[model samples]
Target: MTGTIHNRETFLSQIASSLGRSRLSSGVTDPEWKHRPQDQVLQDATPDELVDILKTQCLKIHTSLVITDAKKLPETLHEVVANYGGGPIVTWKDERFSKWGLEPLMKKEWPSQKLEVYEWDHTKGAENIRQAEKANVGITISEMTLAESGTVVLFSDKDKGRTVSFLPATYIALVPKSTIVPRITQAARKLRELHHSGKQVASCVNFITGPSNSADIELNLVVGVHGPVKATYIVIDDL
Candidate 1:
């Protein structure tokens, strides 16, 4: 009976592989991704200029922010955040934000501010969600940043709650220059590589291009319907 069961499982596995429905047997690696153009990647692109761009492209600055570039998250964040009103709470995604060594930085920069960082454990409950909804600003790292459209991609998982990025009135992104892809096609290629690596794609992979703005009411422009009203991207140099 055991042998029969094992054989049946193997047969089904083979069929799934043939149909390209099997899980990733290989880890995170893809040569095709390496060939993507460097020009397409987003970067610092003038922090001062970004301020103006956000004004024209964005609808409201209610949730205004100062995002740090990915590589120079240390350098840019400390300086930029100093000017904004002291935020009540600071949020982060679990893996990348944790690995990037933000705890020490947060302590140093937001010493007096209430600092709250959560891991994507799914069971962490919904406190982060509720806080984010009322937060003056929300900060997180992006999987990819699009320079062309000035967008950031948030891949929410167990640690990085989706609400931390969306529910907040203001959204700030820390994007690494290297992760800035020129087009959606390049992003798709990278996504395929990530999927093939057996990693769990977050239930919500949100693509945020500036703040939420719509001109649906007969030429009247409105912002913050489905997401944030204010958005800012901090494109950091490679660390």
Candidate 2:
């Protein structure tokens, strides 16, 4: 047991060091990969044009879902769901949806709406994705969201599996305002870091901006032809 422990620690340290060095060489070491400024920390939606964008996008999508930090579950999630037709709220084990005083609130807003609150364990990524796909909507917390391209980044590990975010019909991602970066290149650097750290690479890493759409044939646009038909994102001000 002692030898095994020593070997594992040694391996992890070596991997972390190599990953750090490689990322630095790849020009990923820069904190700001893009010149665009980080998105503003939005507290109230009324003033920000994002409100109109959110409303329009939500109405256009088939399913609207929101994934917020367990510590910062937005007060508006239930309201939005109720207005757009209620759907399930899939979360991770640490999300603490029940403890955050959300269950009762949702119950009140959507007395007749069915709420499927699932706790994700990373080992069950395959199962979780299957369940998320069956539902019309799915929401999961994100590591970070890029504002310029409207892309969301997800990392896989023991707690955050990949399926919950990628397989649903409409994916609602909750990202902290602080976690909002300017570009996908910054996100790719983070992924490279994770890869070098010897963490198990996710079977899937999705960077979703809008609804799953395709203009593959005749330049005619189509939605839900491949992935989720819709995606709604809420960048909570607080982490």
Candidate 3:
């Protein structure tokens, strides 16, 4: 079920032959660009400075941002869930929840509060999507956060359903301070490095900025046309 390209070598060979050039798969280095402005953008910003940039960008993207330490994360999450109208919640089956001290809230607090919670189950298949569609809130941890664009990078694997972010009424992203990168340039470089190191990257990588926004209808900006109407990012300061 993996998205591995079986005919990649043959396909590239055919293209190379058509172009009258040998397949240059080995000993080929990346070209150097003199005017690489993308690398320069926010390049010198510290993590704290990046957070500040992200905060400002969030304001532009219509997303709420909250800063809290690991110790306060559970409480902060609870408050956010309450504000978004306690769920029918859907979340990724990620271990970071326990690592960041949210196991209690996930196992006890939410259930005791009579909130219906569903974690993404790969085995359940369509059932997960059904739950996500009915969910009032969907929660996920950001693999990476882009400061300049206020974007959250989601590398979707089996346990992380894309529908969890797309179908819910509200979305909450848990962003670790360490994941706060200056921009997409750094994120792209990280992905490239992973590929070069022969690591298995996720089949789907989603770069989400705030909620679903579109200006297709009458050229007027519309929010939540195809996804969550409200989005919040909880930035963990000491995770």
lDDT of 3 by residue, 1-239 (tens): 65777998999999999999999967878798889999889889999999999999999999999999998898899999999989989999999999988886567465347778888889998999999999999999899899999999999999999898989999999999999999999999999999999998998999999999999879999988999999999999963
Please give the distance, in angstroms, between residue 205's alpha carbon in candidate 2 and its true position after superposition.
Answer: 3.3
TM-score, per-candidate, Cα-based: 0.63, 0.58, 0.89
Question: Which structure among the candidates has the greatest TM-score?
Answer: 3
Q: Ranking under lDDT, best-scoring first?
A: 3, 1, 2
TM-score of 1: 0.63
Q: Give the TM-score of candidate 2.
A: 0.58
**Highest lDDT: which candidate?**
3
Clashing pairs in 1: 41-180, 42-180, 63-170, 69-236, 119-159, 120-158, 120-159, 121-158
Candidate 1 wrong stretches, greater than 4 Å: 1-75, 78-84, 98-101, 104-121
User: What stretches of model 2 exceed 4 Å from their correct place?
Assistant: 1-74, 96-114, 122-130, 192-204
| Model 3 deviation from native, Cα RMSD in Å | 2.7
